[model samples]
Target: MSTQQFAGANDRFLRRYEYDDSWIVAADLGVADDAVDVDVVGTTAIVVVDTGDGVAETEFELPGTDADVAVQNGVLTITVAK
Candidate 1:
């Protein structure tokens, strides 16, 4: 038998992202690898970024079955394709 337990992995923050052509744009999170994390939760993509002052979280709704997450030029980008 397997026991199911919650890992307490709840979304600490919620935010919205700007939608572009086949992509979602998140806020600029400055530069710090330790302060940034991207995760795919079910059908939504989550981005967490901390800048010493506070943490910024952004979520993008995926439109398709696949998603690709990346950070470039201090910005978080999520690409979704159908």
Candidate 2:
């Protein structure tokens, strides 16, 4: 999944990336390429930014108000708060 928008004058360039969770993981070993990290902390739900690092530290969690969700450096982090 990806999206693009042109805020510049002529949109001389293209900005695109992929976004999907069909088969994803979440976690971190250290500072990721994007400089942030996020994980569900208990299960296997994790969201990464730009590390090319792989899903070894990620966890899983349901998305809801009780989801201790957070973001750092560009990654979405989910924790067990409820």
Candidate 3:
């Protein structure tokens, strides 16, 4: 099977295309912070996870309130699509 690189995978896309605005700024969802880290070696993106820290990430493949995700307290969360 071939792998498709989503816009999220590209660093440029994340910094420029996806979340690009001057005056008007958008929330970094949950997984879009320098403090936060992620690893998508296989296929990942557009997902949401309950950080339990009063935050929620975006959802992937699923609509509205559904997305594959995981969360941690100290270390990074590992998200894999179901």
Candidate 4:
């Protein structure tokens, strides 16, 4: 599978990038650690963001297996086994 496969969800807060063997989901600025949450439920990747006003979320059906989720530098990177 390719990283593009992980970018099925379209939202204004998140940007998806395809890497050599990983998929990167970048959270927009102003999204703090406490404001955002990411999870991989089976083959689906769910991302929730909460600001002072309200909460927003996005979900994408991932590709491949052995999925891993990592957040660093204000970016969420999901690597999968394919």
Candidate topping TM-score: 4
Ranking by lDDT: 4, 1, 2, 3
Please give, for residues 1-82, the per-residue lDDT of candidate 1 as tens digits. 1121222234232233434445443444556656779998777777777778778676655656477777776665565653
Which residue runs does candidate 2 get wrong by more than 4 Å? Answer: 1-28, 37-44, 52-59, 62-65, 71-77
| All candidates: TM-score | 0.55, 0.25, 0.22, 0.62
Q: Model 3: runs farther than 4 Å from truth?
A: 9-56, 62-82
Candidate with maximal lDDT:
4
State, as a TM-score between 0 and 1, how close model 4 is to the true structure: 0.62
If the candidates were sorted by their TM-score against the true structure, best first, what order would they fall in?
A: 4, 1, 2, 3
lDDT winner between candidates 2 and 4: 4
lDDT of each: 0.57, 0.39, 0.31, 0.63
lDDT of 4: 0.63
Q: Which ranges of candidate 4 are over 4 A from the true structure?
A: 1-30
- Candidate 4 lDDT tens digits, 1-82: 2323222334445455666766555554355666668888888888876766888777777765568777665466676664
Write model 2 residue lDDT over 1-82, tens digit each, in one string.
5444233233322232324532222232234445545554444455544446543342333433334555554444343332
Candidate 1 Cα outliers beyond 4 Å, as residue runs: 1-27, 31-34
